[model samples]
Target: MIEKHTSNNGLRIVLENIPAVRSVTIGIWILTGSRNETNLNNGISHFLEHMFFKGTNTRSPQDIAEEFDSIGGQVNAFTSKEYTCLFAKVLDTHKEYALEILADMFFHSSFDELEMEREKKVIYEEIKMYEDTPDDIVHDLLAQASYGGHPLGYPILGTEEHLKGFNADTLRNYMKEQYIPENVVISVAGNTDDSFIGKIENYFGSYNAEYKPSNIVRPTFLANTIERNKDTEQAHLCLGYDGLPVGHENTYSLIIMNNVLGGSMSSRLFQEVREKQGLAYSVFSYHSSFLDNGLLTIYAGTGKDQLPLLRDTIDKTVETLIKSGLTDKELTNSKEQLKGNLMLSLESTNSRMSRNGRNEMLLNRHRTLDEMISEIDAVSHDSIQKVIEKLFNQSSSTALIAPDTSG
Candidate 1:
């Protein structure tokens, strides 16, 4: 069972106890990310996440690292399009210690001038590394093609120019605007009990910030095609189709549908693109659901000479799926696979904490295992057909990174 509580100041806490495990994972989730940023601060949310570990008012960066190492705990943080999470996993005996350090990082980060300059150089290298990976950066190009000039199209790692301008004031001001109590959730999973809630509340609760009503503008999906010429051996292609938002009633249907399309080795994209045609080594599709909209992305990488065949094959596959829909066998297998994946994920404390944290942060609700399985089983052919039609009714946005034609 997942226990939930709302603190007096609106910080939400979710705890799931797994008596079989000897460890606990705690995550601090904030409902702010690149989507909430402007062009000027396109990467501040991610930059701020990096700064949290530089040092806290009470602990040096090395001290923090050594403390966690001494306890054999793992700590990390990441920034995504719609949210940021700072999380830790440690033995149950060290749960309180982990929480305290996380809280200190949250509330007392020094954002030292020297550290800021040093981290800026680190992020500059990080940006360069991302630029060097064509296959990886192609997805960011897809976002640009799909959302056009919207903030949703912005990359999580802001530009080097933008990163240079971020100082202590910039971080604090951004936090004041985006990191309010109502937008925060503290998630815990493993051998801990509800008593741990009080300790979390003691640290995170009672903090007050000016609560400004949310003014997030929903992004409009565009079917624009964006192509980049790079000196590369393979052409990277991505297709983005408009899909449903988070917690839509047909979410299970879409998941099963995607699984049949390209989510697994037995999937059509994998079977047809790689096994039979030998067009590419990597081919897959995934769905990303945001607060108000979603995107279903299909990706394939192939030698420059085979790019045309790869595109034609993908188009034919999508067309066939649209015309004939899913086979009953495919539907049944996908549903079972989804359920199995869910069950296997519950075996890990980190997965449980992440699931609970995201559920509470985005949906503000949790469902039982039975309820989830029931929903997955309830996905029917008609429902999946509806989702398929809904997702592919319009032309898709396209992004491609191919060898330079100038040569």
Candidate 2:
């Protein structure tokens, strides 16, 4: 079970105690990411995440590293389109120590000028590395095709020009604007009791930032096509369709439908595009849900010369699924697989912390295990058909990266 508390300043804390495990995982979830940025500050959220580890007021980067290593704990952070998380997993005996170091990194990072410049050079190479991976970058291109000039279309890694402009002031100002109490959640899981919530509050509570009304604009779905001819040996293609937002009524149905389409090894896309025709080595699909919107993405890579055949096969597979709908076997198997995945994830404290943190951050509510299992089991063919129709009813945005053989 999970216990919830709200700080006086509106920061929320969620704790789950699993007495059987001697490990604990703590996560600090911030509801600000690339979608919260502007064109000029496209990747500041991700950059700021990197900066938190560079140094704090009292701990050098090396000191922070050695502290975790000394205690056999792990710490990491990630930036996404809509949120950022800095998390640590440590033995139960070291939870309080881990929390102190994390709080230090969060509140007192110096953002030194030298450290910022060094990280900028590292990010420059990171950008170049991303550019060189055609298959990886094809998805970013799909975002550009789908949302055009919206912040949602911007890459999480801002351009070098923008990176060069970031300084201590730039980061501090952005944090002041977006990292308000109402936009943060502290989640902890495993072997910890309710008393830990008070400990969390001591470190995170009472801090105040000027509340600003949200000016987030809901983005429109566009079906633009983007093609970048590169020097890669294989062609990478992605197709995007309009999807339901987080917590939409038909989300479970959509999940089952997507699993049947391209989400797994036995999925139609995998069977038709790869197993039967030997078209590509990797082909899959997934759904990404945002605050007010969602996107379903299908991706595949094939030999440059077989691009036409690969695309045709993928199109035919999708067409067949939409027209005929899912089989009884597909529906039953997908539901069971999803239920198993959900249950298995609870075996680890890290997964529990992440699940609770994300649910609290996005939904502002939590459902019991039985309730979730019942919902998954309740998925029906008719419901899945509705989601299929809703997802594929519109034209799809497309992106492609292939060799520039035409020249």
Candidate 3:
């Protein structure tokens, strides 16, 4: 069973003690990400994420890295569309040390002006790197089109101009306002006990102020023209449509549709595009949803010569599925594959730690493994068809990336 507690200051902690597990996994999840930024503030969340490691009041930057390296422990962090997370996995004996280090990184980081200036150059290079890669750029173009003018449509990495303008005072203000306990949660798994819970309270329980999340109004969906023209050899293609958010009843069914559409090698897109026609090297579909909005995108990379035929093939696949629907065998197989993947993830203490945190922050409840397996098992072909029709209708947005190979 997973234990949950909330401090008077609104700091929520979830503990799942796995006795036989040899290490402890500790994580801190902050609710701010790209979706929460303003135009001037875009990418600041990601930039701030990087700055957290520079140092803290009690730990120098090198001290932070070496503390765990000396323990044969693993430490890392990432920023995504919805949240930022920092985690560490170390021997059970070092549980308190891990928590203390994590807290210092989160609450007391010194965002030096000198360091921020240097990192600005690094982030600008990162922007150029994304532009140089067709695969990365296509996804960026897709999001830009999917959400249109919404902040959610903007790239997670703020533009080069914005990064140049960021400074320490600005970053410190952003952190003070955006990274707060009212919008944060911590998840831990392995070698946990009441003492572990007590230590968490001692370290983090004091930050429990009633901080309100910033208010930003986003549109329900976007229906506008989106096209990107780049000088590349192959035309990148993407189409966006509506999807259900993560906790919806039909979310699992949409996951199945995505699986069959492009998720696995045995999927329809792979078999049709790669095996039968050999028209493209890669093609797949994915379902993405925010707290209230969602997007289902299909991406393909092919030459200008194959553009017409590629579109036709993709359209044909969607039309066929909407009409003929999925077979019981396909549905059953996809579910099993998904279930197996889910179960496989539980084997790692790090994966479990991150899952336990993100799930609660997103769902407000922890679902048992059996409950998830049963949900996957219950999806039927008829329901799958209904979801496809709803998601792939004509009212979707399309964006593409291509090279000027003719030039």
Strongest candidate by lDDT:
1
lDDT of 3: 0.84
Which residue pairs overlap in candidate 2's backbone? Answer: none
- Total clashes, candidate 1? 0
The TM-score obtained by model 1 is: 0.99
Residue 315, candidate 2: C-alpha displacement in angstroms:
1.1
lDDT by residue (355-393, candidate 2, tens digit) is: 999999999999998999999999998898898888889
lDDT of each: 0.95, 0.94, 0.84
Question: Which lDDT tens digits does candidate 3 get at residues 1-407?
Answer: 89999877787899998898889999989888888888888989889988888888777788989998988888888888888888889999988888888888887888877778877888889899999887777777777767877878889898988787788788877777777777788899998775687899988888744466568675566655556678888888887887887688888898988899888899998899878999889888888877776888888889888988998999898878888888878888899999999999988888888888987888888899999988998899878887988886757677877755455
TM-score for each model: 0.99, 0.99, 0.96
| lDDT (Cα, 0-100) at 49 in candidate 2 | 97
Better of 1 and 3 by lDDT: 1
For model 3 the TM-score comes to 0.96
Better of 1 and 2 by lDDT: 1
Query: Candidate 3: misplaced stretches above 4 Å?
Result: 208-210, 405-407
Please give, for residues 263-379, the per-residue lDDT of candidate 1 as tens digits.
999999999999999999999999999999999999999998899899999999999999999999999999999999999999999999999999999999999999999999999
Please identify model 1 stretches exceeding 4 Å from their true place.
none
